[model samples]
Target: MDRFIECWNGLDDPRTGNAALHDFHEILAIAMCAVLCGGQGSVDMGLFAKSKEPFLRGFLRLENGVPSHDTFSRLFRMLDTEQFRAAFQRFMAGFSEQCEGVVAIDGKVLRRSFDSASGKSPLHMVAAWGCEQRLVLAQIATDAKSNEITAVPKLLEMLRLKGTIVTADALNCQRAIAQQIVDQGGDYALALKGNQGTLHDDVVLFLDDPASKAITAEPVVEADHGRIETRTATVATDIAWLNKDHHWPGLAAVGKVERLRETAGKTTSQTAYYLLSAPLTPERFNEVVRSHWGVENRLHWRLDVVMNEDQDRSRLGNGPHNLAVLRHMAINVMQKDGEKGSLRGKFKRASWDEAYLARLLSLF
Candidate 1:
């Protein structure tokens, strides 16, 4: 993978031959190392790369390559981040195809650069995640014209959704999207909200109408945080939505949800409505919903707080986007490299270990 990134990098012309940094391999490796070193900008990446040469040399054979901070910044500032992302996804094609469950469709704004006075080039990406495999399958940029709802179906077309359950928040609960997921041989578990005027009204009314009982199921889960004891649970799934055709092509079932929770000494909870393409009892629906939040806590929150992703503004052409992708790749590698330990600490270990870098590049 290191060689591949290096070779891919060399594909670009640096305009100047004798510059301190004209090679992509060295630049790419440095940028990647910077991410691994907790560096959040191109300058930081270049410094990190120089600071850890002995360790990097053990993995990347940069016989006589050293890119300056400006070189690193300029190269990334011009390189096609979207193209690089596509290439990386191609590299992980085999691993992505093995995904077995819900392929979540969502979008997140690179908040820090939303107002970069240089015109509206802020990147908005529609990402498809293999929820079951815990891997990001693919991502497409939503240009200045569209939103997640508009970008989803087009993105789904690029993926092979066979036997998968594509889940999303209320924003994606559209008729066309449901049809698209079913058409691709996949199921869906879209959240039901007020956006679907009639449908939402019906689900609410139906659940409230006393005669809505259809199935009975319950699940009890316990969790503790040293001093506090908490138990979370779900107690409802009975509804007619799960049995009706509802006009959804491959639709098998749909339902409502009731969540009960007791934390510390106080207990509070709310009911959330859901539409599922599978008759997975109430117990199962709750599991998927809870797991979905892991994306927020594990990936999003960690990136923002630990990796400091949301704060950086490396405002070059494709620089920011490319850097974001590199950071995610670094996260995945760090997670897979068991001995590296926590996300915050992985950069240190990655900077010191050569075999680890080789191992990361070799992984899917």
Candidate 2:
């Protein structure tokens, strides 16, 4: 995407010259592509590029062109990240159609890089991943030291939310964020926690008030990790936390859980409380609200465990944003490729198939 790279630069070409990669562009792109295909580190990128020399030489202007690991680092360090992320949003827009249901909004830190002395900062990015659409709709950077409270709303504004439900964690369970989602023509299922004293207390009180029962005999049967399990659960309450002065929006019902788990001839149980963003209906609220954790497990877990993304120090200049975008794009592409279910499997597919890997980046 030479044209894309140029467009992302977003500055008029000076009469002096066009800001081109001067052949180094292709190398960097190729190298970045290799990295996304499971290059472990700078050295891994170099080796991957070398291994593909014969194939890369065909489409890339590799003649008289070679980039050391430092070249990759310095080049990414020079990129205008915000401009690029905007361009990336546009590039990804065509692929990220609003196919259906609720979207998940969350933030994460590249924690290991927080203290890196290489001038790379730890990153806090708010991402809106459409579970139903199977793609990331938008992502924005939060200040490395702060929460994503402000950034989350901004990121949602960039999205096309015709029939979407935005789900976030406890930190985002405020009236403003919830109202923002409604204002954007979307619904929210934000988790309630101790962060909001009044709301948390109110929900707890409603659940504990001896009458709110949200789930009844909700039995979930599924097979996972070579095991078959059945879960029968209920939601009943005893109010000890709700206050008279607190206001809850779209607050359907507050309740507690009673989960009985049976597996391998052993039966265990659990109980807890939850605050609902929508009306309290056993089928709808129980399924969607409870399923919110699936987003964290399915996406973020894979990002860390398989892609090793959170461990990287790609935070200089726009390096953090660019790398984050690339990583998300890679996951989306891999998910669509039909060969892999997990991030590691996708990387394996890319590493095994150079042509397939090329196809992955060509979309960029």
Candidate 3:
């Protein structure tokens, strides 16, 4: 509890005059604990506080009694989202060391956060997920999906990327972004699509030629759920002529992944391209490419499916972004817990067992 208070002590309270009945950190603490126990919104936070007043008072001082639902809602709606995000980063850093291995950067839209009456669009957040740590390193909310190009650089500024490989989808394959990654002492493997126009076309044309002599890795075949899939990776490090023409920053190699899938006896094939700052072997290239999807499969999917993040209707003020950060904090805490169980099971156990919840809180 002292650690939690110290991490969030710098947040400025939005309340003024006599409106500050409950301590700000106390409200945040309650919200975090409630979320870890599967609480969705302000109402759930209030109910959890009232029900767990005794458990909470063991660490917190309830000088003015438990704060009402309105308090939680109002504070969250008015809180500085940037400050809250920074506090979360600091809190997580206090426990977890600098991230290593593949760091996947991606974006997800909070579908239900849109307000029809107010002409508000769904909130879109671009997050950096540390593949090894299985934690959300940092996130920045964008006004729209297209704004991810601008948001990605800002998100990268918040992380320590030295010696890590940062991967992103084709939409984030900008020269400036690639340069920024190298500038931060990290390498990048960004996907390529028509968005890059001539560059993508040139790579495709060159790799399709027989004389390019790109090294190919052994095909990896998998059978699951009545589907059989095969993936073959090809890498080309002899790109001196290509770099001479393009002058791409840190241009060391180009990669191609050919995926063949058979479902219900129908076969389909797809080819994808990538720009890498490092000249990795075909097998290492395959590993890096496959690990990039962990951001979606492990982090985003868990938040949306397990935590019901998309269904949350928090459209007022900074409520949506702030609540999303709380969900990230909950995931980090649960991921760090050594107990053996699925995340859903942990949520159930934590809510039912106060001792287990205390143990989880002590992990950070």
Query: Best by TM-score, which number?
Result: 3
TM-score of 2: 0.80
- Top-lDDT candidate index: 3
Indicate whether candidate 1 or candidate 2 has the larger lDDT: 1
Using lDDT as the yardstick, the better of models 1 and 3 is 3
Provide the TM-score for each candidate, comma-separated. Answer: 0.84, 0.80, 0.97
Model 1 ranges off by over 4 Å: 1-3, 6-21, 58-65, 143-146, 224-246, 264-267, 338-340
Task: Report the C-alpha lDDT of model 1 over 1-364, residue by residue, as the tens digit.
Answer: 4545643532454446555334556567667767776788877876776777776676566766666678877777676755676666665564554657667777766766555576656667667766666666777666443477888887888788887778888888888998888888888888889887777777777665666655535555556562332223232344445346256555555566665566667776666666777777656766666666656666667778888877887765776677777777777666656663677766766566666656666664
Residue-wise lDDT of candidate 2 within 1-364, one digit each (tens)?
Answer: 6653643445322112333334545755775577668764455666777777787776777755555665566555566666657766765766765535767787877665454566655788778777765676678886563568878778878887667666677777778777777777766666667788766776666555556644465666767765565544344322232323555554434544445566676777765555544444555555665555655776778778887877775555655666677677666667666554567866877788888777776665
- Candidates' C-alpha lDDT: 0.67, 0.64, 0.91
Name the runs in model 3 displaced over 4 angstroms.
none
Q: Against the true structure, candidate 2 has what lDDT?
A: 0.64
> Per-residue CA lDDT of candidate 3, range 1-364, in tens?
7877888866899998777999888898899899999999899999999999999999999799999999999999999998998898888787567879999999999999998998989999999999888888999998799899999999999988898999999999999999999999999999999999999999999888889979999999989899998999999999998899899999899999999999997999999999999999988999899899999988899998899998898889999999999999899899888677899999999999999999888875
Could you tell me the lDDT of residue 75 within candidate 2? Answer: 55
